[model samples]
Target: MTDTSKNETNATGAPVTDEAPNTASADVEALQARVAQLEKEVAEYKDQWLRAVADYKNVKRRTDQERADLIRGASAGLILKLLPVVDDLERAMNSVTPEVYASQWYSGFKLIPQKLQTVLDSEGVTPIAAVGADFDPNFHEAVIYEAAGEGQGGKVVAELQKGYMQRERVLRPAMVKVGQE
Candidate 1:
């Protein structure tokens, strides 16, 4: 065999090898391909991670909104039950004589329901209109129907029981009497 070290140099004056050069080039190409593939995989994994994080944030926001809504509804129900007591106090205060208004007990009773109603109004609880308007099935329940004197049909003649709303949602339907033609 010829001396490989002596035959290694090519005509371009660059050092050349018999086996090591080709082997080294092939190994470098393989390493580059491997690096490209790993980069693509890393990018895919990063995209998946970003999507997962966004989904988790959306779920957390939805849960917080629902919890807040539940708390508001619970408070509204308690206030709704107290409205009848307020109405009774109003009646009592209206019917009280001048001598009774001068008494401490009568003044205390009058102030209590008014304060309660003021608090409820500040919290978005409101009474629905049910008297003399057209009866609506969505907000009013007609327990009694009667024929009016003239030109009255599908109109609410009387409200037997009051209704209430909280933030555009009906908390209770009005019990009413409707006039029919």
Candidate 2:
């Protein structure tokens, strides 16, 4: 048996090997098998690369959402701190006498509180309902319990200090007086 790939011609110029067909078929099969293996490996690597890119995109999207949320709610702490001042202003307005209420100074004082409320409204800060509504632990903190009429048990009778919410989060839980039988 001659190795046809390196076979030399005899003096008559005829090749010595009789295995041309077998050699060609075997070489074709080997080349076909190598091509298939390369294709399979390429497909596997492409799948992995696609998954990695998708994972990176998902992480980037999540980070962007978190950053936006942080920027949107950055004023929450300052608003929380200023609520006590707002409460004091409201109390002062409630304690004013009719004589003082008609004075220029009283009107100016009233406008200040109104401006504070306007500022709160502009920031999406909203006052939680306490009076007459059912007492909710999520929105109200019961500081004192008071006597209630029928059908009013477990309801808020008064708000000692107003509670506030920014967006959907409770910035301050309303200090309230709950009523019971």
Candidate 3:
């Protein structure tokens, strides 16, 4: 008669097969979910790194522009303050008559101012035109108003103090008398 026991050995001495363990499928699914989550995290970190690099480049560019502007303004400020002294020297040169022009002292005085102006010109300091030109509030400051004759309104009558510019920026505004209709 055959044995009634469920556990039996085959001819090769291996145990008889039964259903697979219930936890096997569940463990495989959990591993796949973990892998997906790790991939998403890696993508987020990559995006953050790209943004940080872009921000650093932008900040560097802005700082460079500001520094260049500061250097330009420093030079312009020094030149603007020296313009009045230059104008006075010019007036003094003009006042010297033909007799005075022949004197050694007058010649030295004139040469000094001319040489100084040449140096200033090399550094990008330049004068603004004020006489007989149309009034521009950006470059001129009206110190006095005068009654304009025919065809003279809105014109610069006289310059009290000369203005100057460095490159494209106005370093000093010209002090002037304006004519009005």
Best by lDDT: 2
- For candidate 2, the TM-score is 0.80
Report the lDDT tens digits of candidate 3 across residue range 61-110.
99999999888878777776777788888788778789989888886777
Task: Give me the displacement of residue 148 in model 1, in angstroms.
Answer: 1.4
TM-score of each: 0.82, 0.80, 0.74
**Each model's number of backbone clashes?**
0, 0, 0
The residue-by-residue lDDT of candidate 2 on 78-122, one tens digit each, is 788789999898888889899998899887777888898898898
Tell me model 3's lDDT, rounded to 2 decimals.
0.84
TM-score of 1: 0.82
TM-score of 3: 0.74
lDDT of each: 0.85, 0.90, 0.84
